[model samples]
Target: MITTVRDYLAAHRRAKDAFPGALLLVVSVFASMAGPSGWHGPRAAPVLWTAAACAPLVWRSRAPVLVTVAVASVEVVHLASAPGQPLVPGASLIALYTLASRLPRRRAWVIGLVVTVALTVALAASRSDEVFAAGTLASFDLLVLSVALGDLTRSRRAHLAALSKRAEQAERTRDDEAARRVTAERVRIARDLHDVVAHHITLVNAQAGVAQHLVRTDAEAAYQALGQLKDNSRAALDELRATVGLLRQDDDVSEPRTPAPTLADLDDLAASFVHTGLPVQVTITGALRPAYPSIELAAYRITQEALTNTAKHAGPGATARVHLDYGDTALRVEITDTGNGVRAADMAATDGHGLIGMRERAAAFGGTLTAGPGRGGGFRVVAELPLPQDPGDAR
Candidate 1:
């Protein structure tokens, strides 16, 4: 029941307006019963003056400056007519407080100073100067105190508003950053899909042409080409499914993701290129260490792209060698082919998108990649990826 009443008092505008004025009126009526000795005037006049002073507080918040001026004018008239009388200052105090809380600091302070001086002068003008001297000081103090309290309230409100605005801006920044990252990841996924399909389909197309040409003249050779086509097709499908599954939503519980290809699959990858008529030799030095999934996938994809480019651009019967060196702090991958290096025209034909994708992937894992002509009259691709410290052994 108390909660309900408090809520009603807060929500009801009329109740807020009436409550202070009603209390002041009751106090004024009671103080009037103390007689001329107690109030320094006839009981009826002081009561009427007090009522007049307290009545205007109803609209204090709505027209604070106007209410304050009106209440001050009433107090001056009351002091002039009934000097040294008991005055109810509630309405004027409410008005000044409301004005200070609503207006900007400089303007509110200026107005408060003017009102304080005016109240001091009016209280000092009484015939009994000795009695009203202390009242004058007291009135000035109350005026300043009211304005100070209002300014404090205003400052707190402004502080809260600023904090709320900063929080909203921070939230928006976080959302924008999240959206940008999501867009980058989608583009990365698209590039992977393109590389997977392009490399496999190019080999398939070339093998199919060979198979068709050799079907009558060389039956066994044609069958082998057809078998390679089947294997390439299956591998392409599996990689596609695995890559696409990564795009599934969290709640999509139907299909599970297959593990992505890593450095461990480099041997099988180079062997597959050899089946397509490109001989690739794999050489590894130093002990292998486990790496993060992203780093492993990046290494595999970079190697795949390099070998695919070799098969497509390098002439037939050209030998390619993949060298892996696991250093103390980094992993190095180098793919060199003894064929004509990538010509400017050839790089321009694909707009160098493959190389760009590889660079982006390498940079994503804080790695570096370079591709150009080899020192020994061929093409070479090299990447160095940093190795992170083991979490289990961290101090």
Candidate 2:
């Protein structure tokens, strides 16, 4: 019984249908009043008629036009029979406003105009003093105002919802852009670290071979190579520290830094590789134009890595040539080693991209790179990187 009552009440609330329900209750009370005390009526069956008239109010919002017609018709009869009574036209007013607010501009206007005219006409014919007068026109104006208010409230709600959705989409777009930038930066650091460290590692490998061979034959050469080993080890560590430290900065807890190596340090690079017992030929063919530091750094790394690869895969009998040709539009690098040819299957092991990290360095500067067996039996790597506008440009 409790559940059934709750459900009935819930359904009633949804329709409120209760507007008509309460009106029915009031009409019943009025009918009882008319019968008991100072009542006089030849048209006796009183309150039931009023209650029946307002029954349609329960579905006013559901069928506004039908509800309006029924209430207006009953009110008309009640006015003709009795001169005075509290005939609440609440149901008609509610229906008229609902139709006007919900329907489109032209439809709402047509419906509202027809209903208003009908109500006025019905009121003029009624014998009741309660018939619509000039004051009723004021009530009609208020019906239109209520309709406009509901429409305005709906429009504002829609506008706010759209703005909220747009803000959420913008935040998602910002997050995606941040993720892309982070990925690009990591690729750049990987390229830089590979270039800077690979060359020094190659030097260590080549010198280790020389010193090992000479330590049993020539004592003087052995002593010199052992010293060179220490220098090479320290140099590699210093370069790694500088490049890595540049990438890792915590302003809250960092010491002052010194300058890092750049293209100007290429002379020292060429000399160190030569000390490793491999003959390297250097050639610069550009018109002496400066490039972006990142681009130049890219160039330095490419050359260094290529030489390192040549020293690793090619035997000591191989001769490596380094070329830096600067064109009007771009800078070019070519490292050719005249050594035994590498098999296609051994590529993953003996190729320049393997240990020297050529492919990664080339990608960092938006450059094109190619590495393969030379025309005869050796190996070659070529890269083309864009140049900066001015000859004095750097960084």
Candidate 3:
């Protein structure tokens, strides 16, 4: 109940209930006085002193030191005129506390000490009150303590407010960053979808037309075209689902599709090349672990692109060597095919987008890649993918 009342008063004092009560407090303290000689000595109208003391409270927040001096002066006069009644010590104490808390501690202590000493001396000279009242000094002590407490409270509140504001600002920054990343990712997925869909759609439509044309002439060739179309369409559907569902799925969206090709599947990749009547040797220098999804995908694409180029440019009997070296910091793969040893100018002049895409994949993982002609005789592609610290580090 005491705490509740105090909180209520503090709220009211800051807002509405302070002014009227303050005026009354000033009046009640100075309204009547017993003169210095036990005869209401040197008594003047109490109303003037009341107004003088009350005037300072209005300036409490703006001019703490000046208001304090004014209130102290009025209190000394009242004490001189009447030593009989106990001065209420009301708003003066409040103003004194505000002064101490609002001002620097050293300044408050200096001013408060001066007020105490001067008041004590005046009372002594008047022979009205003693320089040292048995219990009167306690109020002055309370005043000094109030200064320290007020200063401490102000510092604490300011620090907390600063910290809270910084935390809120940081949270807003994180949310904005996340939103930007999401937008970029969505845009990237859209582009990938367009390419993947468009490429396979063209193939499927062309093959379907071939199948329809051959239905009357050679059924075998038509069936072969239809089979290729089925495979192409299914692959496109599965890959699209994997890429698109990444945005919608909650669990393990980072995980690639179940049959997603890894370095382990490089044998199958090699078989495809070997079936094309090329001498393709895949050499694994070290044990290959299941790498991060992104790294694995990059490695696979690099290998596949290199092999496809060998078949297209190196002719049927060209020798190809794919070297996969797993190292401490990164996985290095080199694909060299005897594709008439592309000249520096030729590699530079080759299709623009393939080289750009390959470089993009390498850059995404802070890796490096270089493609040019081998010193012996052929085009060579070298890709180095820096292995991540793994998901455990993230956890």
Candidate 4:
């Protein structure tokens, strides 16, 4: 029965208002019957006054000032009609509390003081012999206490509301940050796949053509071309497997079979192009030193993409040169071809995916990449990647 009543009060606002007033009326009526100087006239007068005072409390929250005035006025009349009744009515206290919590501090205090003074004066007047009795003083104290408690409740509610808003903002910020990281990871994976597939597949297609042509003429050269095709295909598969491994969830137990390619693998990279009948000469101008793995990988992929573009678009009889220069602050990688490749105008008009990927990779590492026709003739791709101040910091 208790749980059912509690649920009904929680669900209904009208029930919350009526429950307290109903209980106060019932308790006040019962207590009035036992008082020493109760009901000097008709016994029903004091009961009617008590019921009237408590009834206004049902609208205390809705019209606190009016409700408080009405209740206090009725209590004063009740005290005059019956002298030695309860000094403070419970309904009056409830009304004062509602007024303090819902209104501003200065206004609430002003109104509360006025009501407290009015009730205290009425109580003292009812007891003509004892003007400043213990009951009058105690009634004043209870009224002030109710107002203080109401203001405290209001402050606590405000504090909890502010805390709830802050928590929601923090959760939203975390979700946005997670989404950004996921998008960046997706773009990085796409670039890796593009570089791997484009570079090796171009070689495989060229080698297959060479083998088909040579098989009709020179059997030995055709066998060598076929062998190079097999190697290029295997290399493509290994790099693809490594790039795809990044998609696995954190709980995944599998690991990539091959390590990421770096500048150290440049020789093997150039040899693959050489087998496709393109002459590539790699030149190093400065002292070789360790660099960040990400930096080296970007440089290697940039070089590979540049050379692949040269072989595919640079007319026949094209020879490409790759230069690596390690300096005090940065590492420079440049690829240039002798054959007249796509003109600058045409390259700009097309805006191929390879150039976009290269630029993105360089930008990711706080570096820069520029691609266009070289000074004399042919295509050129130059990427400048910053090196760490201390070589030991390279990872």
How does each model score on TM-score? 0.82, 0.67, 0.66, 0.87
- Please report, as a residue range, the 10-residue window in candidate 4 with the lowest summed lDDT: 34-43
Residues 128-208, model 2: lDDT tens digits: 334456655665566566556645654666788899999999999999999998887776666666665677777887788
Clashes per candidate, residues 3 or more apart or on different chains: 0, 1, 2, 0
lDDT-superior candidate, 1 or 3: 1
Q: Considering every candidate listed, which one attains the maximal lDDT?
A: 4
Report the lDDT tens digits of candidate 1 across residue range 229-284: 99899989888988888888889875655578888888888878877778889999
- Model 3 misplaced stretches (Cα beyond 4 Å): 1-51, 80-85, 123-130, 169-226, 249-259, 267-294, 305-321, 326-330, 338-367, 376-378, 385-395
Which stretches of model 2 miss by more than 4 angstroms? 1-134, 246-252, 256-260, 343-345, 349-366, 392-395
User: What is the lDDT, from 0 to 100, of the residue 46 in candidate 1?
Assistant: 65
Q: What is the Å distance of residue 285 in model 3 from its true position?
A: 5.0
Candidate 1, clashing residue pairs? none
TM-score rank, highest first?
Answer: 4, 1, 2, 3
When 1 and 2 are scored with lDDT, the better candidate is: 1
